[model samples]
Target: MADVKSKASVLLVGGGSVGAIAALNLETGKQAAVTIVCRSNFNAVSQNGYNIKSCDHGKINNWKPTKVLNAIPKASEGSTFDYIVCVTKNVPDVPPSLSDLIRPAVVPGKTVIVLIQNGLNIEKPLIAAYPQNIVLSGVSLIGANEPSPGHIDQDFPDTLFIGAFANPNLSPQTQKAAAEDFVSRYSAGGKTQCSLDTRVDWTRWRKLVYNSCLNSICAITDLDTGRIRLADDAVAHLVRPAMLEIVAAAKAAGHELPATVVDDMIEMDPLDMYLPPSMLSDTRKGNFIEYENILGEPLREGEKLGVPMPTLRVLYYLCQAIQWKNKELRGLVSIPPKGNYVT
Candidate 1:
């Protein structure tokens, strides 16, 4: 048995639906003291705690971690965290880069950085920024969202797979041990399923087949997953082809997924599910969707690998327009006069 007396200090950034559930579990086992950064709902969470309606854990009322704050504390606070887990969206094109957001808590070689996010090659930037630190990558499949502040609705249970990102500065053995330790601590709650994955990149590629297709398509059409599936030939004409393109690109990049993966992803949801993906929810809320992370990165990879991704290219162009509109609405970007681009 592991030493239960030795408790690790964990700082979890992003207290949205996914982050809340992760924080809940991280503290449930008493293995780690968790401090969550809730940027949007700090007051609500601090006052009343999170109200989670989970299928796995049942109705969890007024669940609070060890600490909750609106922002990360500065380094001058004199507290170095053992693990900094970031469940925030990876929108590199957006302002407030991930590195800058988590820089305050990083303790050189001691603090491990863990990212549970979507998209391909999301670990590269962190690995570059923290060369001497161990970086862990997590991929999760859970249906969860915050319909209102401090309230989480989770229809699917949390099942997270974590692995160490490849880093030249740290030995593979060291990175793997750190990842395994996190998996153990994260699963201590016994409600969630957390496991260590050796082939994490391949796992990500497998997920991309679904994320690159349905996630983008649902957001573009403004339709829920069920309605998209019920549309006329939407699965055959749009979804499957796009998934095939992603699978081909993954193969070119040295990850060979199964041929039936497309079909499997398509059938995963029921026709009446009516669940909106994270990207679609962002679109509905007028927030900037992760177009660059989810689509642009994969499209660029496909181009570099010489893989033909025509369907994905179309989706990428459409998502770019949507993201641009979102930025314009929020005044985060400006458009020049119509005549400014005269040929």
Candidate 2:
């Protein structure tokens, strides 16, 4: 096994909330070199730096980067990175949009691609594309979002679990070393805990179960997590049935998740909790939600495996309808007036 270094040159795709937090955390490691690429073309981030506002860490402003590019430029041509972290949404069709952005920064055999997105379906396509590159699956527990163009808001502090997907050639020693290096960088940098996992299947499914319950409900209702957590029996009546369908789906997928994870999906009162889900935030910002990736795909998988998921199937279709309605409303609101209203 090769000795992993304390620092690594990283190319981070997706400068959304999670990406920003990763960038801030990377700053604590003196040896680490980091660059951020986003669709927003945040050239100002490279100039004035990032301002991260967090409830746990107060205000962190002017967190500069080694480099920041609005888009991955040709100037970065032929440059290979030690690590490539994909923090974008897990829409299977969207990988092509990122292929051009990622191709230049990747160096076969040495670069490790860490996917820190929602859903279990990302592994297959990423592995198929970069067969020679190391592919690792990761789940982020933190909640973050951008309120404006350059500002990041951290809703909660959470841990990161990372492990290999299907690379049998990845030695246990090498995996542990790589995981340790990541944990050290984040822990030393004052970010949340980073842990190595041999069995990430449970971790990934646990998160999926959580999202399957929370994300679509929040999006359809236009409510934050607090509201859902504090919802009364009427809401529970609606939610629990759907959750059970997800459990059935998971079973069909060959993952035996504990029933307790679903039974206790919302354990706290919303009045006491202050967190909002990414899906709800996405709806608010008029951005595309990973609806298909998170809800639709699992439902399809369940059907393929002959699992009954009536509630999930219904919820998925309902969420899609709601999204379409929301989009139509936004379009109507954005239209310019041919003449001023006389009212």
Candidate that scores best on lDDT: 1
Query: Any idea what lDDT model 1 has?
Result: 0.88
lDDT of each: 0.88, 0.70
| Stretches of model 2 off by over 4 angstroms after superposition | 1-6, 41-44, 73-76, 93-100, 168-177, 229-234, 268-274, 321-343
Please list the Cα RMSD from the true structure of every candidate, rounded to 1 decimal place.
2.6, 4.5
189-293: candidate 1 lDDT, tens digit per residue = 788999999999888888888888999999999988899998999889999899999998999999999878998888766668888888999999988888787
Look at candidate 2 and tell me the lDDT of residue 91: 47
Error of 1 at 78 (Å): 1.2
Q: Model 1 residue 100 lDDT?
A: 81
Cα distance off (Å), candidate 1, residue 261: 0.9
- Candidate 1's C-alpha runs over 4 A off are 3-5, 336-343
Best by TM-score: 1
Would you estimate the TM-scores of all the predictions? 0.96, 0.83
